[model samples]
Structure formats: structure tokens, C-alpha cells
Target: DIVKANSREPISNEGDIYALIACCETGAERLSGMMEEFGIDHLDDLADYIIDTSYRGTIEAIAELPKGTWRNVLKVDGYEQEIDLHAALTIAEDRVALDFTGTSGLSNKGINVPLNYATAYSVFALRCIIGPDIPNNAGSLAPFHVTGPKNCILNAQPPAPVAMRHTLGQMTPDLVYGCLSQALPDRVPAEGASCMYDLPLRHTPEAVSRGDEQFALELVFSGGTGARPGLDGLSATAFPSGVWGSQVETTEAVAPVLITRRELRPDSGGPGRTRGGLGQVIEMRSSDNADFMLFLSVERVLNPANGRFGGQAAAPGRIRISRDGPDLPGKGEVRVKAGETLIFETPGGGGFGPPRERDPDDIRRDLDEGLISRQAAHDIYGLEP
Candidate 1:
């Protein structure tokens, strides 16, 4: 019923219909306890059987879309290399499956996505696009499937690099959403921080090696979210993953560096009624002669996340060094040398409506907040400069 209502397909809930999905973590001991708490005889009687049930519902939702509608794009970052992800989206009569069979295997670095986290983000994308109206319940997830073989990056085995699961995990929605755009062109928004600031850094080696010296790490920043149907993308927010932006003072305090300038980029959002999210510029430098290491899990460099309808892609993310130095590597992990300031220009949100249709009054407010420049307000919104 939910699928039919959302996708306009004819799917009825039968008496035998039940959603049963499980993960390796759902052991007998845990299941037994849950059964007792829920007043069920066995673990199977639980409302939802698996932890990654979210992904199951998501795949099912995506499957409800017409055939060949979903396109998958895999983006891999970290460890100074790029892995082009190849993915497939398919659905069975009563169930859906998201197969990442051909993708890369677990790596020495922490790029692996735990099955649960993978399922979490995969379903998040589907919910955002396909089944927004459907309640995220066991019944809503009855029709889909998701699986990647053990030892694969999406389904890593034991002893795999699990420290940075979020790095690759966060990209799954954007990857799947990128495919969704082919079928539902206007439904998708440009990507924002598919992966949040992968600021897994150690204190300056000089300070840390000394064992007594207090050192600062790095302050990774977030930008605006992609614009929604009728709302502007939020500034300095993390979406899809629902993570919060780390406080600048907290970040600076933890590390030996100082955040010089951190502010919203004017006119960074895509122009529209529901404008794309804004971006931000973050400046950081070592207070002393300390060295800092950065685990840069970033994207939107080569392919700035493209916007829907006629909206433009948000600004590409860039890493700038002091003295107008050459562009640094955009993807993977890298180190920041001593005495050089590192600046991160984050990506902006995709536009929801045409720029010209934006309200003049709202444009004025944006200008006041330094979110959009006076020139941009005049040019994009046709307001007086």
C-alpha cells in the first residue's frame, strides 16, 4: 500500500507478508534477550529482525521505481587514491536487493563500511527520494534487499580498517542518489559533504613525540546542505548522516592550531526559491612550528555534485595553502606541512528553484548576514545593488 501510494504501483499487503532481515551481530544471546523484553517466544517474532533493516526498506523503495531508473555511482577517497565504485540496483517480485558485488575489497586503510552503516545510508537515500511519505517501519521495508559480499569494502571482514567507516559510508547515499537522478531528474539535489570532515588527525608529531607538549590537531569544517523542494539548504550543517558541525573553539582547543577565519561563503548556494545550502571557508594555521597530519576523506573536486532541474553544481571543494600556493590533492588522505596555513573551501548546496524567482527581501537578508554579496543579490535576484 505504501509503495503503491508513493510509486503509484499496485502492491498489496498480504497476510503472509513479513519483513525478516538479520545481520551477523544479531546473535542468539542478544536475540533471546530481545524476545524476552518484547514478550515474544523467539527472536524471529521481533518487529524488525535485522539491524540493517533500514537498508532493506531503502532498497525496496528504490526497487519500486520503474525499471532502469536507478543509476549507481561509487566515490572512494582516502589513502591518496581514488576507487571508482561500480554498483547495481535491482528488485525481486516481493523483495529488493542492492548488490555491490563488483566493488573493491577491504583495504589496508579505514575505508570499509560496516554492513549496518552501509544499510543505514543506503536507506537514507531511498527515503529521501522514493518513500518520503512511507513511515520507516518494518512493513515499509518488506519489499527490498541489500547485500555486499564479505571482505568487500561495503562488507568488511574482521580486522579490516574500521576506524574510518564513516568516510566511505557517508558517500553511499550520494552515490545511489546520483543514480536516482537519471530517473527522477528533479528529485535529486546536488551533493554536499558526502563525507564529513575526515579530521582523523594526531597532534603535531613534534609536540606529541615530546609526550608533555600540548598540541592542536585540525579543525575540519562543514558547508551548507543541498537545497530541498521548497527550502533553502541549511548553512554549516551536516545532513543525510545527521552529524553536527564540530565547534570551532573545540576543534582549535583539541589541536595546536588556530582557526583564523571561518564564515559562510556569500552567494555560495545555488540560486532558487529553495536555494541550495551555503558553503564556508575555514582558515587554520599552526600556532607554533608544529606539524599536523590530516586524514582527508573529501570529494566534489573532479565532479562537483550536479544540481537538479536547471540548477548548477555547487562550488567544488578546494584546499588552498598560504601565499596562493598551487591546488592541493582533493581526494584521499594527506599531511599538512609546518608553517603553512591550510584553507578549506567547502561545497555549496544545489538550487531548488530558478535564481530569478528568489524573493528580493530574502536576498537582502542574505546580504546582511554576509551569506550573499551585494553584487550577487543584484545579479542573481535582479535586486538593486
Candidate 2:
């Protein structure tokens, strides 16, 4: 009966092949239906045409820029000290190359980036600056070439721990934008809180007694985006990572954590003609009387986001316990006692233009909306509250 249902099933085979045949038949039918619906007679010809068009568009995009080498150096808060991320972008008539020849050496921590991951972000950055409308594929990506020194932070060798690669990998867009900003001043935006603030929390043995089931939780949070040429940046928005913020209810339901407050921080955005996005303040505490482990791997602490075109740099990020204890480093694993509150203030984005060029009405609106404090309005924006 099974063989009869699948008409193309091999009669000589003793094993039941109905499921396998059905899957293959369904895939083949879908492909054939698509071809027929689109009236595709020559698949090879259509593929070739697509490749040729994409390649031409990519080349034309590169041809728009003047041939020159632009360089930028970015500093990241490493485990012990600051680490530098250097890039030299060379633009030619047909292609562009980014060489990470002078970046810092490999770290003894897990924050190192693999070459493939670095290249992916580098290509993404270039695409954001040039030919963003072009479809991303092999042909469209052919114009970009990225290389880095083998033992550097951007290209770690084997046997090196890279569990937290995205901590530094996501910074490539901001690093590359530093160079592109010099090439096309009007097109690029200022720096932003490029890295994500991810917290991985696991329950302790004591918490399992009060809970239904022991669970692991991951909470993702973003800082701010860089201000653009024509508009103010979005507050508490994800930049290059494109990740969504977690909901308070969703987090509370799965874990024994209480979210006390989550709101935008006042005076966190850099003031300029187009102001940068605002960072946020999040406060939480343990709901149950049980301690837990907190894994913190975040960035934009020591080195805040940089500004462009005579603008001011944004405020750096900070993490603390109850706002009274000592500030914690950007990356580490620590234990939190039960009922102890944790506070995280993310970094703000960099402004686009000079503060003097900012409109007075916008500054007034910022004061009215409580986005900026009265003191900051007077000190930074040169306005009276």
C-alpha cells in the first residue's frame, strides 16, 4: 500500500521508502512549478544575467569614490587595558580593500574575533556606506577584499578562545565608518554604541528549589545609534547588529528576576545639529532569595562613541551594583547576591554636527520633553531652562 501511494518508489527495495520519495517528489514539484510559473526556459542564462548585472552595479558603486587611502584607529576596552583596532581602506577604480595590518595582538580572553566573522562585518559596513540598495550575493560582494594580520585581535589563530567574538566583531562597522567618514563626509554618520550589551544568566542550585524548572536566560540590550546627516538618531536602538530588545514580561516569566525600571536616560545623547540617539538605564533584582551567575560581555565603556564634523563625543557606558558600589569592567563573569539590584547604563551615540549648529527650537523641545536636564541644557546646548 505504501509503494502504491508513492508511485515512483523502487519496487525491489524492501525498506519503506515512502517518506523519502514523498519529500523528494514534493521538492521536485515545487521547483518545476516555480519554473513553469516564471516561464523560465534557460536557468543558466538567467543566472548569468543576474551575475553580470550585480557585478556591473558593484563596480559602478566603487568607481564613484576617488582613489585614495583612508585610515582610522579605534580603541576598545579590553580585559586589562585598551586595545586598538586599526584599518587602512584603499580604494581603487574597480574595488576597495581594508587591511587590518596594525590592529592589536590576540587577547588571552574570549573576546577575540575570527577572520571570517571580521570579514563579514567589514563587508556589511562597506555595503551600508556604498551600494546599500544592491542585492547581497557573490557578485555584489566581489568588489570588497578584507585582510588582517594573523595573530591580531581581528584575526585570531586556532586554539584561541573566541566565545565572545561579537563583542569586538560588531565594532567593525564603526571602525570602517571612521575611514569612510573621511572619504565621504556628508554620507557617513558619526560613531555609535556598536556593540550589544548581552547578559547571560544561569540559576544557582539554591534557586532550583523555589522554581518550577531551572532555566538559563539571555537578555539582549542595545544602546544608541549614531546621528545621521539630516535627522537625529533613534534612542535605544540597535545599530549594525539588528537585534530586538527583550520584553520585561517575557524575561520575568521564565526567570526569577524582577525588572524594577527600564527607561531612557536623560542627557545621555550627544548634543549637536543632529543629536545622537539616547542610551538607556535598566535596573533589576533577583525575585527569589537565590543568587545567580551573571556573564557580562559588553563594550563602549572606556572609549565612548566618537563624533564627526566638529561634534562632541557621547557619554560612555557604565555598570554597577545599586549605583553605590564600584563600577564593573565591560567584560567579566561575576556572582550576584540575592535581592541585590543591578544597574546598567548603556552608552550614547555620537552627534553628527557641531553643537552650535543645533536649532534652538529643538533644544527647547528637548528640555520640554525632559530628554536633557536643565544643567545640561545650559552647559552643553548653551540654552536657559
Q: Pick the candidate with the highest lDDT.
A: 2
Candidate 1 has what TM-score?
A: 0.70
Give lDDT per model, in order. Answer: 0.66, 0.85
lDDT for residue 222 in candidate 2, whole number 0-100: 83
1-385: candidate 2 lDDT, tens digit per residue:
1122113343323443677788899999998898999998657877878878888998999999878999999998987678999999999999999999999998899999999999998889889878888888888898899999898999999999999999999999999999988999998888899899787877666654665345576787789888888888788988888888877887886677888999998877877888888899999888876777788988999999988897778888999988799999888887888889889899989988988788989988988888888887788878864
Steric clash pairs (candidate 2):
none
Q: Report the lDDT tens digits of candidate 1 across residue range 1-385.
A: 2122123432333332542223334566686786788787854534455534654555566566666525475555544466665567654444546777777777787767788888878867866677676667766655656788888788888878787787778778777766666666557675665667545555544554575344333334676677765667887677666766656666654456677888887777777766778878887777666676665666665555555566656676777687588776664555677788888888776676677777778888888878877777877778875
TM values, all candidates: 0.70, 0.89
Highest TM-score, which number? 2
How many clashes in candidate 1? 12
